[model samples]
Target chain A: MDNPNLEDLLIACRQGSDDAFRKLFEQYHMRVMSTAYRMCGNIQEAEDVTQDVFLKAFKEIKKFREAASLFTWLYRITINLCIDKERKRQRRQKYHENVDVDSERITIEEANSNENTRTLDQQMWQDEIQSILQKALSRIKPKFRTVLVLKDIEGLSYEEAAQAVGCSQGTISSRLNRGRKELKTLLVKMGMGEEYFQER
Target chain B: MKHGFTQKNLSAYLDAELSPDKVQKIELHLQSCESCLRELQEIRSGKAVATCFENPDWQDTEALWQNIQRLNISTPEKGDVKNLEMKRTNLWQRLIHPRPAFAIAVLLILFGINLFSNLKQKKFQYQRVQLDQELSYGFDYGLYLDALVAGSPAIEFERRYESQQASYEQARSQTTFRLASFTHMPKTFQLREVRLLKNACCRSVQFSCLENSREVIIFQQPQGHPVTFGNYPLERIELNGQMYHRIKTGKWTVLSLQLKESQFMAIGEMNESDIAAIIFAITTI
Candidate 1:
């Protein structure tokens, strides 16, 4: 999977070597899908973003220089594309097709059923914590959500998050703060304060 | 500090982004203030929950997608309509306004392109045979083999030749070749084409060989010396069981050699059969 020649293969691809380009695409296709899926938080949207990123990358790869590693370049592109899609998503009201009902209720039911074999306290608390977190995450704006994902989830630094979204570090720093604060507010509302928010 | 901090500033403090002075101030304030500290803890927990989404089982689809790329197959089976129509695209329109026809067309073109490229032999043949027919070209080859490995030059004349990128309508281009000999060969170095300035900088003589589908590129960069890509001389040497030509002076390596029509560079190392097959492929083309 870690073929050092992947970059060289990409160069050949940009040079119109169809064979080389195919190899490059195959090597990174799933990783790109994984990243997109994680960022978008939905299977279909993830698939769509993955398809879009690769298509866009294929078109613009000729302009890609060795200024950045190929994975970094692709990572930056995927995040940007997803962020763009997300902003647009916010403008239009979004509804989850499958999980349209109260997510917390569904999670509680699922948790209760799954934890039947276990003692009730541990199972109940786990379900309660998860539902609280999920509901809270759904309330934040996409910008903050993106920063949260990249930083906490993807573990990117402020500068890297900024570069991915085409913003200044100051913006990322601020947005991340805003996101964390919102999460805290939501968590406090859910009464999961001590379990999850004790150290925030 | 009166408001304690903005939501963002407090969050940043939790993330440890504040400098020493700022960090100290935030810590002092948060230590005394239970409300903000509680908010901070909540935010951190929420942030941790979000990590669950970070690394999902995207790996399951990895194989499926890799196969897609390997097969170079676009399932939608639609011709590219965007490039066909020549629609406009930029951040502004792409963001607020997406051209479905244009976007889909662009997507279609891209998908088609990928489908063609990834269709290596292992995957489904798909439409590759048809696409390959469109892209494939005839080959005519030249052998500096006669002169590829010979002597070394001290004073070298290097040249970066002209290059052209082909378009969809024009996938194939004729290759050009030239050869010249010098009094001495440089020890071992490749002439770089990547950093050359606009002008051809060598004292070049004008000459042309019979036109063919092969290009034998020998270029060099001499410290404190000027070289040109025109008709400069070349030399050859056999080093470590492989033959390389040093054309026209010091520190030149074979930049690249192309064989046309169903042929490939043995890449960095080649045996006799590979070399002969390369020649055969070019000749057959």
Candidate 2:
């Protein structure tokens, strides 16, 4: 949609119009849900975070200044919520450390069985690669992980990433560098061959 | 060229975040640097791996929106759009143009300090008035005597005796020291009232005499008791082998003398000679 049209839609949403809100959700829900999924490493949590983001955006639509684009604002909220969810997950992991080991082993076995049943195809291979990437991404710290997700995965420019992260462009550049190095090291350590990353 | 490029520079160059000149310099350095090129390739591979993780299609957009709408229904609305827009504009203006906001914050802080100091001063004044009232009613004898001799309004006595003999008897009964009485009286001055006074500092008997419109008071207390009253300078004089300390305050004269076991003070608007004569005529008998 054009800028003026988006502005009008935002105004309508601010006026407590449910139709405008639904239109906004239709327009950006994919991107929001996708980013949430990458950040959370799970579809369920991504859906939950996406719902929370839209609800918060709807409620705070009035406070939305025109200084930033709507997408940037939504992304900022998504990143914050994702980080909060990550922290809670970490706390839960610590609480159920012993219980989590068995569950994690079962999940890995199930994933192997599912993969064995799938026909060897490009789509399945891509999905497997995506899953492995997500696991590595989740292993990295949230600060660097967010930068990588925004810059590499989501393809946001450094300026846009800086705005979404509420930081300077220099900080974004620095974090992106570290995040790339850490992700590369983690992928190599995960025994993913260098050929997997070779351009198809 | 020797160091090629730092990881940060290479990363920023890959993202096209660096300035054109820096990007040109790094590009030139990369041509001659094999290790940096290898590192750059590794970073590219990482980026490629990350980019391969495309956004999984979310099929539950409608369900999620419904859930969001349901949640939004329960949450209270902040305000109408127009009011919120105005507030947002004001907030943005404050952020974008901070000088006015800073000036207003300073003014508010100054106003708060002024208000606090005024309240503190008022509280201090109130406490001082309360303390003065308590001291007066508590019969601070020194302050009362000072006020009387200075011709200011003295604190009221707790009890007044109808007759001089009755007051003298009460004074003698209440005190351990020998009480002195007037043997001879001045013809012009007639006794008016007598009061017994006591406080934390000391206890004394007060005799009030009236000479027409003017008044005189005599106080008798135990010798060596502490006095907490005026800051007046004293003059000493010997009359009939009795040493008297005299102080003049405003129009009133105070004459004090130590007898055998008691201290007697006469306060009145009288000449020095008359007060001295009154003191000499008083005896323990």
Candidate 3:
């Protein structure tokens, strides 16, 4: 919001400047992709959500008021779209459980094979840790997960997270509290000891 | 300093979101209260762990932008925007300059419709209550089991099995139907708790499993006594000559399948892959 170049780009985007839109996408796509990835817990789904978010922002660029920053607006869209995607995935799962059963089985087998092929080196260890953390995060309730992703992972301020989630700061604080506790319990259960999280 | 800081306060403290005065008070309290200090450490550790989650590399910006542009081929023309603005203005003008007679007529019609709909709704409610009373042992029973798994305080019953084996043994002794034991489970899940569900007409045993931190409940009842989830559209799938029914309620997925004389319902917020794996584990076992 404070960037004059961003403001000019926004103006140009509103005036149907594709170049300006491209610039804006390049600036914020990584942020959006990261947020979506953490929220969805799957890289493919995150990519899909990122695409949808940009498409939605482009389509509704004319209606974007300057009351909120472009980042916050795009974030709100990303969260809403991620949530929608989650719901649709749940619904789709109900019907296509068997149809994709074999593919999922193969994915699990491939993951196991990949783990075996990769040496237990530092990078593999890091990837394992990241995978465990993601699994724990995916187990959390969506409301709590979103807050954690936006505030903790994405490094959004309390005010910014509240604006993006369309909630009061108090709600965000409470959700963050619960989310952190749940994540800790999950991490501990997933073999990440409490001491691992503690500072040296 | 009468009590330790609330979780919200401690959480905010970790994020440096507290006011100067509040931060000073918490710091003062943290020195004296080991319990509060530990809680603060745990919260900080949790935040640190969360911060360690790095964003994955996403190098598809150009491709994604191009896809967006391709999908947005029908961009609104300048004339279209002007027409939309004109229409919005006209709508505002009409709202500002309403005819009193037309407004009164429309209000009267709306009032009449509201009255008629209210009457109809009352009749429908009466019938629904009657239907619910009849299906209380069926539809409401499933919800009661769900509530129990969710740990709803509204339930007056306080019966829980001491262990999984005890639960299975008790259920086997009490019910005439065959109890299906999950000899095999998905690798990611572990059996956590078990509870017995009993009412006037039917009996069931609820097995709760923990997949990571999420709770998955599997309910087993006699085949003839089906747990009906009222008004929720269920998707039916046929696999290996057995029919399975599934439905999504919010984030939770309810999947029920019949095996011989036992009816099994598994409810959890699991992906399709996990659900399929669970189904395979159950069916194969």
Candidate 4:
């Protein structure tokens, strides 16, 4: 939707229009859900995060003030919810060893299995690369992972990422550099070594 | 040549985040250094691989939208907007333009007086069915509650106590949560007034109820405040899987429970059982 249409929808939403809210949700749910999914690496947690972000957005839309784009505001809420869910999951997992690696592998396979656009071989290779990348991304600290995901995966500019993450542009630059370097090391270790770099 | 540019600088260069001078230097160095060039290329490839995993666009939009709609979330209704605006402009106009606006002010005050009297009559009828006693409580209840709330750090209870009062319907309209989330109330005890007090320290929503001559006050604050309600004995109890603190001081019983992110406190001149029953009704619903 165009900017004017979004603004009109937002105003209607602020004035308590459920239809307007549903429209807004339709417009941004994909981006919000994907960000949450990528951040937490779990489909269930991502769904919960999306529900919370929209619920909160709908409740507090009047106070939104439009200081940032609606999507940026929504993304910030998604990131926060993902972090909170991760922390809660960690606490609940104090006694149990992590089984996410195998579970995530299955989830990724199941996710790709449904799509017919890619050839079987291509799908398998893509799933492998994605699973490895997600595992590596999960290993990185939340601060760095957040910046890297916003910048590279979400395709947010430095300024937009900074606003979404509630940090300065300088902080985003520094975190991106550190995050990219860490990711590079992890990818190399996952058998995507010098040859893979040359191929890309 | 100076030592090779650091990895962070190279990353910055790759992202185009560097100043022109630094960019020029980094480009000059990269032209001659195959090693650095390879590293940059590797970083780019890593970013590409990381960004490649697109979870198929969320296919369950209808299901999710249904879930959201079930929340009963909505902005303030038109009537609520009119009332809120009336309240704000009434106060400011009276203070700023009292003399020349006398005629209109008088008419408004007279209208308000008529409305309030009618509300009082309705309340009396409701309270007669609910409470046998006279409305024995006064602003002292407000003071006691304020004292209890004042124990929390950062709230200006004295200032808030006066400004927070509003009609029950107004409070219902403005509550942060849906009124249903607040749960059921005893039929005899009609909501007389509601107040929302907030500052940098805490946010509180107070609901005042009247039964005959007795008054009940309910307030909610975010959890984690160090709150004390005098030297009264506090008995910890659990009901409906929720924990509560029951404080009995002579004729007054106060029930405090923490739900989600908010701690709710209900106080009145009643027994522990009555207060507990009210707490249960409010919390579980």
Best by DockQ: 2
- Per-residue lDDT for A1-200 in model 4, tens only? 23667777888999878799888888888888988888998777787678778877876798776733788888898898789878988887762334354565465455445555246467566666666777778777889989888888888888788889999877786677678777777665554534344323
Residue B188 lDDT (model 3): 50
Task: Tell me the whole-model lDDT of each prediction, alpha carbons only.
Answer: 0.49, 0.67, 0.67, 0.63
Please write out the lDDT profile of model 3 over residues B17-111, one tens digit for every residue: 88999888878888888887777776777787887686666666678777666656544543232333344366757665668658878999999
Give the alpha carbon lDDT tens digit for every residue of A1-200 in model 2.
22558988988998889899899898888878888998899999998788778877887888896734788888999999999988988887763322333444444445455655455565765676676677778777889988898888777888888888999988887787778877887677655666657755
CAPRI class of candidate 1: incorrect
lDDT of 1 by residue, B6-87 (tens): 4456656666776888777777778778887776666666665455433334446555456335333342322122331222
Cα TM-score per model = 0.45, 0.53, 0.51, 0.49
Q: What is the C-alpha local distance difference test score of candidate 2? A: 0.67
Candidate 4 Cα deviation (angstroms), residue A18: 1.1
**Ten contiguous residues with the weakest lDDT in model 4 chain A:** A191-200
* Interface C-alpha root-mean-square deviation, candidates in order: 4.5, 3.6, 4.2, 5.3
For residues B1-285, what per-residue lDDT tens digits would candidate 4 score against the true structure? 232553446656767878898888877877787877776776777665665556744567789788666644332432232233344366767567857688788899999998997666432221111111122222233444544433331243444444655332333355332121222244434334333322222233333333432445555543444245655667998866778887765555567777786666666665545665566555643
For model 4, the DockQ equals 0.15
TM-score ranking, high to low? 2, 3, 4, 1
Q: Please identify model 3 stretches exceeding 4 Å from their true place.
A: A94-120, B1-5, B31-35, B74-285
Single out the weakest 10-residue window by summed lDDT for candidate 4 chain B. Answer: B126-135
Model 1 chain B — which ten-residue stretch has the worst lDDT? B125-134
Badly placed stretches (over 4 Å) of model 4 are: A94-121, A193-200, B1-9, B28-42, B73-285
